[model samples]
Target: MNDQGEELLARVRAVLSDAGFDETATGAEGVHLIRHARGVMLGWLPEDLAQPRRRGPRRSRRPAPADLPGLRRAFGLAMAAALRAAGLTVETRGDEWLLVAFERAADAS
Candidate 1:
């Protein structure tokens, strides 16, 4: 990775770590690696729970399995916002992996 790529990777690591996700699962090797070419591909595991959750008004901190999708969406948006705030024109997308493409300044014209 180049200098820019390294900087971006650090930024992403900080973002995800602050949001309760780690690049590596507990007691294991790194969970994912960042790949950058035209864009950056960041892979991280979603929620860990496997069982369905009960319908209720009150619950613990953990989200229901069904809520994983929404949770991921929130995380993605948060990441994108952070990147934008850093003054990098960016387009973010993902399923279980996040793909962040920086809109090069020269290409913005």
Candidate 2:
């Protein structure tokens, strides 16, 4: 990889780490963060009026038990948002990963 590629990867890794993903033991494979679907929900009423109760304020985002796919999807959504929030340009590469890079001006030579 060239210096620019290295720099971009480093920046993406840092942002992912800051957003709570654990670096994969393989390192270069990728990073991942998992949060339960429950944690991502807005505490909305689910189902056909099962156990009814008023909505409660969720003070903080926390993890809980959920399916692997669900967790991955949620993580991807959040990770993408964080990267954009950090001011990087992002493009989805299927559902598995994102292509992130520093934003460039269209007029750049």
Candidate 3:
């Protein structure tokens, strides 16, 4: 990997760690950060029916079970996002990962 690619991967690992994912659990293949979204709702009920209820949203984002495919997908997305943040372009070619970043060519002087 080029320097930029390596740097980008490091940043991605850091982000994953900050997001509560295990950095050591990651590899060139990828990492996963299983997370869920929750929300609470409050409402008034009809008399003699029920009191105000706190309900959670029916739709929530849940993490997939720890699996190879799940980890790959999560890792790929995280790495891609990190690369973008670093102004690099990432391309996944079949089983190969490619990262392109601008670098100043060596000066002949």
Model 3: ten consecutive residues of lowest lDDT: 36-45
Q: How many steric clashes between backbone atoms does each model show?
A: 0, 0, 0
Query: What are the per-residue Cα lDDT tens digits for candidate 2 across 1-109?
Result: 5566556667777877797753564323346322222111111111222233447864323222242346556667787898788887766655555667444658956
Q: Which rank order by lDDT, best down to worst?
A: 1, 2, 3
The better candidate by TM-score, 1 or 2, is 2
> Which residue segments of model 1 deviate by more than 4 Å?
18-21, 25-33, 50-67, 102-109
Best by lDDT: 1
Over 4 Å off, model 3: 1-67, 95-98, 101-109
Q: Ten residues in a row with the worst lDDT in model 1?
A: 25-34
Q: In candidate 1, what are the lDDT values of residues 33-98, reduced to their tens digit? A: 466685567554454545466697756645543567776666656655665665544554545555
Give Cα-based local distance difference scores for all models: 0.59, 0.52, 0.40
Of the candidates numbered 2 and 3, which has the greater lDDT value?
2
Report the Cα lDDT for residue 56, model 1.
78
Q: Tell me model 3's lDDT, rounded to 2 decimals.
A: 0.40
Tens digit of per-residue lDDT, candidate 3, span 1-109: 5565455456555644565544333222133322111111111111222233458855322323332354455555666565456554445533223333344458998
